[model samples]
Target: MEFIFLAAGLIMGLGAIGAAIGVGLLGSKLLESTARQPELGPMLQTKFFIVAGLIDAIPIIGVGIAMYLIFVVAA
Candidate 1:
């Protein structure tokens, strides 16, 4: 039972860390690309937002699974 909690915590922690790194890199690359071509800035910004949402989904799914482990599986 205790291990279940540990597993859930690990899941959430790692998921958040991975997502943070992904978004950070994504933002940096976006900035770099926009700096290279100002005319494409708007189009790049649009694609950046779309990719960011997909990156964020990973952590959200992790949270859902963690919650299930804590509330349902551990119960």
Candidate 2:
């Protein structure tokens, strides 16, 4: 049971770190491209948000799962 809790915490923490790194790398590339093409700023910004949301999705789901494990399963 304690191991389950630890594993759940690790899942959420690692998920968040992975998402952050993914979004950071994506945004960096998008910014570099936008800098190269100023006219594409609007389009790139929109795409950035969509990509960011997608990157965040897994981590957010991990958080939900962690909560369930901590509050429900461990209860």
What TM-score would each prediction reach against the true structure?
0.98, 0.90
lDDT of each: 0.97, 0.93
- Candidate 1 lDDT by residue in tens digits, 1-75: 999999999999999999999999999999999999999999999999999999999999999999999999999
Q: Tens-digit lDDT track for model 2 on 1-75?
A: 898899898989999999989999998999899989999999999999998999999999999999998999899
Most lDDT-accurate candidate: 1
CA lDDT of 41 in candidate 2?
95
- C-alpha-based local distance difference test score of model 1: 0.97
Per-candidate clash tally: 0, 0
What is candidate 1's CA lDDT for residue 73? Answer: 97
Question: For candidate 2, what is the lDDT?
Answer: 0.93
Tell me the TM-score of model 1. 0.98
